[model samples]
Structure formats: C-alpha cells, structure tokens
Target: MVAPLSAWPWENFGRFKYLLYGPFLAKVVRSRFQEDGPEDSNWCLHILIICALRGLIHQLWSSYSNMLFLKRNRRIVHQGVDFKQIDMEWDWDNFIILQALIASIACYIFPFLENLPLWNTKGFIALLTLHMAVSEPLYYWMHRCFHGNHLFTHYHYLHHSSPVPQPFTAGNATLLEHLVLTGIIGIPILGASLMGYGSISMIYAYVLIFDFLRCLGHCNVEVVPYQIFETIPFLRYLIYTPTYHSLHHQDMRTNFCLFMPLFDSFWKTLNGKSWELHKKISSNLGKSARVPDFVFLAHVVDVSAALHAPFVFRSFAAMPFSTNLLLIPLWPGTLSVVLMMWAWSKTFVYSFYQLRGRLHQTWVVPRCGFQYFLPFASEGINKHIEQAILRADKLGVKVISLAALNKNEALNGGGTLFVNNHPNLKVRVVHGNTLTAAVILNDLPKDVEEVFLTGATSKLGRAIALYLCRRRVRVLMLTTSGERFQKVQKEAPMDCQSNLVQVTKHQAARNCKTWIVGKWITPRQQSWAPRGTHFHQFVVPPILPIRRDCIYSDLAAMRLPDDVQELGCCEYTMERGVVHACHAGGVVHLLEGWTHHEVGAIDVDRIDLVWDSALKHGIRPVSSTKAKTSQ
Candidate 1:
C-alpha cells in the first residue's frame, strides 16, 4: 500500500523526463536570465527577446498537446450531458501579460519600478523578485477569501461549476468578482503606487508568465511532467500540481494556494490530501465522460467576457448605479438556497450518491452543531447536504435518504459545510435511481409525532407511505403536478389509505401525544416510551481491501454510526425515503439516527465532566429544550 497523499502519481514518468532534460534546463535558465549578473544584463535585450519567444513556443506546444489529448480521449471531452463538464476558457493571455506588466509597475513601487536612481543590474533583479514575492501571497490570500462562505458558493461557485476543469475556466468569474478578486494582481501599482514605465513592464512580465504557467498546469495533457522538478525541494515550490488545483475546484477550500506553493506552505493550508482525493473521485465519477464542442467554446466566451469585464464594467456611467443593486441575490434568502440545492442534486458531480468506495464519511466537531462533510467530489454540492443535515439536526430530526446521495458526505468530514454544498447532489437521476426518495417510508420514531413528505409522487415516496401505513405511524406528503403522489394513495391498500394524515392536527387529537421529555433518563432508568429502537450491527469486510486508500474510509468503530440502515438505500432505486419529507410541507414522525456524524469524535468521559459541570451550574442538554407539565 503506497502513501496516497504523500506520493505523486506522476513521479515515475516525470522523474524520467527530469533526468532526460537535466543539464539542458540549467543551460536555458542560466543563459537567458544571466544568473552571473552584469554579464547577463549586458545581453539582457537579446536574452529577454529570445526568452519571450521561447516561452511562446512552449505555450503553443502545451496547448496543442492538451487539445490533441482531448481529441484522443473523446470520453472525458464529452463529460457533461449538456456540455457543462467542458470548459471553454480561451483568452488573450499574451495581451493580458502585456497589460499586467504595465499595471504592476505603475500601480506599485512606482518610485523603484521607475528604475530611477537604483538602476543597477542587481537592482533590476531586486525589483522583479520583490514584485513576485509580494504579488504571489496577495493573489493567494484574495483567492482564498473568494472561496469563503460569503463569496465562493455564489460568486466564485460559478467559476468552479465545472468538474473536469479546462484552461478556459482558469480565471472565469463575474466582472465584479473578477476585478475585486484580482485586487492583488496589481501589487506594484496598487501597493507602492509606482509611477514608472519600467514597473509596468515588470507587471506585464509577471502576469504573462503567471497566466502561461497556470494554463499549462490546468492543461489536460501533461507536458514535461512534474516529478522531475517536484522531488527537488526548491523547484517543487515553483510549479502547482494540476491534480492539486483541480481538486481545489472540485472539493475546493482546503487548497487555495495558486501560482506557487509559498502561500500553501506559509498558511499551512497546503492540502496534500487533494491529489489522492482527486484520483479517488475521478475514478469513481468516471473521468471518461465526453463533452461537447459548444461546452468547450462556452468556456472560451466566458473567459473572453470576464477579461473584457474589467474594461467595460465601469463604462455604464449612465446614473451611477449603486453596488447595492446586486445585494438581493447575495443575501442568499431561502429561495436561493433551495435553487442551488435543486441544481446540485441534478448534476452528476455529486460523488456522494455513487459510493464506489469508502470516500464518503464525516467527523463531528463539538463546538459546531453539525457534522463536517469533506468527501472528494468533483461537483460542489456538499454544502447543500451539510445545510440539509443541520436543518434536520437543529429541528432534532433524522433524515433517511434513498436519494442515491453519497450520505458519505456527512461521514466524510462533511458536517462543517452549509446545507447546500454537499457535492453528493446531482442534476437528476438515471430513471430509477431516486434512492433518496425511499427514505420517506422508513420506520418513524415512536417519539416523533409529526411527519413531512416533499416529493411524494415518486416511486420510493409512495413506498414510504406504504411502510408508514403498516407501522401505524402518522405521515404526510406534499405533491405537485409532475411528482404524481396522489397516485400513490390511490394505489395504496385500503388499510394504508386509512393511515394517511390529512387536515393534520384536526384528526390528530384522537391517537398520539406530543411530549418533550422534561428530564434526562438512561434507557434502563426511564421509559421515555414503551417502544424504543433496536439497533443491530452486522460486521462486514473493509470496503477498500487496500489500506492506503482506506484512510478516507468511514468504517472504523469511531467512524461508524451508533445505528445504521443498510440494504435500504444502498442498492434500492426508491424515490422518497422512508424518512423523507417529500413536499415543501409534509408531516413525519421523525427518527434520530445517532451516526458518527453526530458523536463519532466525542470522548464519553470528557462529556461526563461537562455534564457534571452543567448539572452543578444548571447547564446541560435539557437545560434549554426542557418541557414541564402542571403537576
């Protein structure tokens, strides 16, 4: 078993290339940049010109290689059914290089960039290095922020919408985010407020080189290979891994460093785990899917628009429109969250549903109320699942999903994300794979007095109603035109129909009692209810026989749930889960499954200390939601 996160999969071939091109690279760098100082500057004019052309040659080669590979590998090219998987990002990278150079010099260190008095050979080198040193970190931190809660999901989420990212999606973002996001790109001009023309040249060079490298790194085909340089400590930091950055977009957040590794190393946020996760997800998600030309071209148009956005953004000076105009969508009101969630589940990128391996699982953080979901999904839907979980948990409800969701998202350190971000969500299902809907029929907790069903007309949804009918549990389901839930009740047995909950509380008074226990009692000490749940565990072999790949697995005793349901949604293509709340409004007798998502990481004895303190100071679980009766 090899180290998944530690080993670079490309090391074999990359090292071969490195050894083959050894002294040649040394000569190229030394001859072009004049590492020997004054002698190099004397030939600076000739050196830079040749270097620029040589760079152009390499860029062309890299682009052609990637395109050729895409042609050969038609499957990955046709990835998304709607071409969403294809990235069409193409831009005037060369032109931008020229532009950034000027901006860098003019906007920052204008005095020094002016190359005025300190105009020595070493001084030129100093200015360039200084410019790079500052720009890199600034670009990184700003990029990191763009992935933050307030920005990434909406503003930045658009850019990462693609799973197998293309070069065109490199810098694709809305104009506002693009410009504000690139605030660090103009370090020299923006920071030092430079006035010199030379500084602008430096900025141009920096942007051009940076852009070129980023494109190469993102290219589907590997040119030169990274292993040769990566193992060598210093050079390793210069190149960003394609696998690394792609995962940043896929299951992003952990690795936000770009350009170089300085940001990752400094912040200690360098996610070595991504490369392994990428291979894990890429294999599971089927990297062989083909994409359409139009999809690829769309990326091109988007990049073109994004690049032009900077130029024409402020041109609309008609009435000095307030930035507040964009505020409505940014607020992320209920509808926005719902729409995002709906879109997420429909897309194929949600790696949760297709749980091929042990990649889906989560860790419970005590301070936070929810579980952390961090599975390696190419789609960005984990946030949605996290939110759904929190929404369910906050309401003290347990969700039984047959939605083919890789519930592993929560088991994969998924708890931290907002409800909508779980990548387990996809655009839709393959005809009969609506396993999440099956949860609608699960056995309700005798303790739960209410039930809600959201997508009731689907197959599994109707099944849930049938199951609930048999259990004598109260259940309600919501319906719309396409779902066809009423057909379910009509098809249900007369006995099942008798259990349907309608006009809810009106007929509810006859049968059940809603009670919130005012006191905590051990299972042996008190009868919260005469009927309680029975949990039975059937031990099974590890999902991944190989251990390295199993580190991401969520089956350790600590990783497994206190209680679990299997053979239920695992292979069943049921719609509406036994525990599913089908419609926007439905009723369900909720059951809480205390999975590892809720208590896996907790130290029982430690909880005892806190419980003792709470008991003494009147602070505890029942401290807040306690119910009292007139005794």
Candidate 2:
C-alpha cells in the first residue's frame, strides 16, 4: 500500500528516487519528484541538499570577512600576518577535505529517516527548543572531557596547537574526534525526531545554524557588533564571539562552549580576557594602524635605602611646599610622597636621541626601588610591572625590556605568567638577558683560556658559561648546588661538557686566571681571589672595590656615540663613561623592532648585530684603556 500523505511518507520513497535517476543527475530528479508529489510530502533529500549549500555559502562568506579583518588590523591581531603562510594553507586544505567527507556521509543517511510534514512551522520551533535544551549541557561535559590529560594529548591537542585559529580550523581534528563531535550535534536532532517534534525542514535549519556558528567561533577576528552587547548587557552572557573562543586557544584553561556562554558562565570558566579583548577591538574598529616602533625600559629608583637617607628626607620635606603639591596633610603627606614616587614612574617616550636604522623612540618606566629586592615585595613589584606594561601597551609600544631586578624576576617562564594573565596585551616582554650575555662575552680577554664564573646556576651565569664553552674556552663553574651543576653539564654538548668543571668551593676560583662575578657575588667574597687575577664584574651596583694589585673592570659598560657626550637620567645621576649592559640591550632591541623575547644567552654572532644596531642609533663600546684615560 502507498504510504499516507498525512504522515509525510515521501521521505521513505526517496530511497528509490536515487535508483530511478542517473547517478550524476539524482539531485535534479529529486527536485522534480518533490514538486510533483502531494503538497504535504516531506522533501527530505531536497532539504539535506539545501542545508549543504547553505553551509558552504555561509563558510565562504565568513572566511572572506575574517580575512579582511585580519589584513586591516594585522598589528593588533596575535600571530600577525603569519596566518597567511603556506604551512597554514596546508592545514586548511586538510580540514576542508575531512569536512567534505563528513558532509557526504550525512547526505547518504538522511533520506531513510521518517518524514514529518514539511510545512509544520510549530514543529520546527519545538525541535529547535528541544535541541538547545538537550545539546548544550551534553556538549559542555564532552568538551571538558576533551581537555582531560589523556584526551587532550591524543585527540584535542591538534586543534589547540595553533595559537591563532582561522575559519577553516574549526573542523580540523582527528577522524575519531570529528566523529565524536558529529555525534554530539547529531544525537539531539535524532532524539527530537524520536519524540515526534521535528520535520525535515527543522533538520535542515539546525544544520545550517550549527555550521555558521562554528565558523564564527574559529574566525580569529572580532566580528560581533559592539553596540548590540553594550545596549543589552545580558546579551554577552547569551552569545559567544570569535574573541571569546580565541582566548580558549590562548590559555586553554577557560571559555568552553559551542554557541552560548551560559554553561561557561555558570561553571565559572569564562575568561575575563573576553570582555577586555572586546573593548580593545571595539575601540579600534575599522582602523588598521601599525604598532609604532617603541621600546619600553622598566627600572626602579633606589628606594631600598631612601627612607633613612638625609637627601631623601629633605626631598620629602621640600615636597609639601612645592607648587604642584596637593594640599593633603601629615598622614596624607606620607601617602602622597609614596604616590608621587609612583607618578614619577610614568612612562614617557625619548625621541631626541636617534638610534641608527629603523628605531628611534624609547619609553622609560621608573618603578619605586623599595618594591624590588625586598622580602614579601614580589607580589607588589609584579603588580607595578603589570601596570607599566599596560601603560606601554596604550602607547602602542610593541616590545618592553625588563631592566636589572625586573629581568631577574622575569627570567625563564616568569614572563609567561604575565602574558597568560593579560590576554588583551599585544606588547611583548623581553628580559634582554641574551644581549647582556653577549656584551659580557665580548669583553673577555683572548689570553684568558681558563675563567671562573660565580653564581653559575643563575640564568646569566649559565648563559655565559655555555657561550664560553662554545668558544672552546675552559670554564670553572662555582655554584652551591651539585644537582644544578649536573643538569647544566648534561645540557651542554658532549665535547663541551668535558671542558666544564664544577667547583663547589669559592676558594677554588682563586687559582683561575680570570673571574666573572655574577649578580649573586658580594664585595667581601672578591677579596678571596688571587692578588693578580683579572676580575670582570657583571653586577649592577659595582660590588668589588678597586684594588691596586688586581685588574678590575665592569664588563656591563657600553660606549656612547662620538657626538653624544653622555647619557643622563633627569631623575637621577648615572655613573660616567658607560651604561649597564641590560639597559643597552633594551636600546638594541628597540632599534631593530625585535619583539621576540630574548631570555637566554644570545649567540656570539648576535653580538655584532647588537653592536652594529647600537652604532646606527649612535651608541658604541669604549675600550677599558680609553675609559680609564678619559676618566
């Protein structure tokens, strides 16, 4: 018997439509058959084909718009224009191939399902309501499971490996992962069908909506209209945006949802960065400005000893009578003095001194010295550094170099904490240790085949030892920990490891011909060195006293250009003849616009580059003899 028209039976009959029509012309035949069938017949095949076409068109449109956004705002976008590289294109191509395969499978299975009436608008709405209710919670838990250690390493890691995702990256996953993801979307629709709430038309609409939202999430460009959320503040919790999903790829610890932020919000997993990123992108909408070339130097005044000094006390006493003083008394005056010191730390660009090549501007951020190097002050000091970085970001500075104690705190993965915490930040933080190591390496005398390096476990100390070993120089490393020494020895090249000798006793260094004193070394310890030994001091405060018997020099000094007589800070007086190597490293990085972090020991080859760039900016290295003669 013929299936009843009221039950919308044409969906079951479509299985034969394929056999009756030619393989290449099946779509045309299906459309003609649907037109000739009863008015209420379920056009299942036609609906599936329409959904596929809609998804394809929407993906192409969204991808084009995303590309335009990235191109126009390349400077603010993470990973910059590297998204257009050939390797990324290869990744996109693989994703498209897999997605096409999945679409083909869906088309094959859809024709066999029971059909509901095609014209039932009420059923379509009910189906969508049911799908949302059942799918979101299930998808949330499934997504969390994907982030678990085992699953993340085996299944979900490929999708997260790319820091900056693009539209095509949405479907880029392992075959098994794609199947599971597909089931998460499909099971709810199948359940709705079993409950007698959906039709072929509802299925088509859902698929189109799902694919569009997925592409939007991975587009890597902020396309949400800022005014909509601003007008209705609650809408932010209701809808998900590209920047929202980008943070998931950035930190991987929060922001897990398909199209709604409801689950993430309820679970307290929504990233705070989402709102900040939205504000940042919204403020600069439609403007494609390049990040200006500027270097930020973060330094602190000598506040550790400021309170007891007569000069500091006098300065505070004079502050209350100054024309700029706000009329706050006693306790407020004390608070005001502290606030004034912080205000003086504001970042300002130095454009007068020109660096050779493409760099010219330098921004200085002078933090209060009391916050650094003291016990229990790290948290406070880090906060100050965060504020400085944020201010530098406002100035469109691309690279920030942490000076002295700042570098010491930011060595290794310390800077990564700041990057992860401030997702809206586009500025790169560099410790500038590499260039500092290069400067010290350049000053070592050629006659010194064997040298003793104190604090060899420190970042700069280890770097110096490695650089010396690479140059075939024998290095005697003095450190407190044997385990650290073994680790460093193992990391060195096998040939170089033999030349590296670890000495636990500080007195053993006295037998060496030369000494490289790291920041950890004190002045009292230097007296133990042999009388005629050459001492190269790398610490900031000049720990070693000038002894008549030893040849002492600070390797951290750089020569200024011939035309420029001296470098001086308006706030404080700097020592004559040379500046600290860390400060000079910031200058070199700024001149070259090198935004990459320079944390470890820099190669010897880079010394020339830094030197040449310094010259371009009109900076040079003064020979020890010349510096002494000039003094």
For candidate 1, write residues 545-586 as lDDT tens digits. Answer: 121211111111111121221111111111111111111001
Score each candidate by Cα lDDT. 0.35, 0.59
- Against the hidden reference, what TM-scores do the models get? 0.31, 0.44
RMSD of each: 22.9, 25.0
Model 2 quality (TM-score): 0.44
Error of 1 at 624 (Å): 69
Please give the lDDT score at residue 65 for candidate 1. Answer: 31
Candidate 1 contains a number of clashing pairs equal to: 117
Q: Which model scores highest in TM-score?
A: 2
Runs in model 2 deviating more than 4 A are 1-292, 303-352, 356-366, 410-414, 420-425, 520-524, 562-578, 600-618, 624-631
User: Which lDDT tens digits does candidate 2 get at residues 276-334?
Assistant: 77767766754644344445454544443223111222122212122223323333544
Which lDDT value does model 1 have at 152? 63
Query: How far off is residue 366 in model 1, in Å?
Result: 63
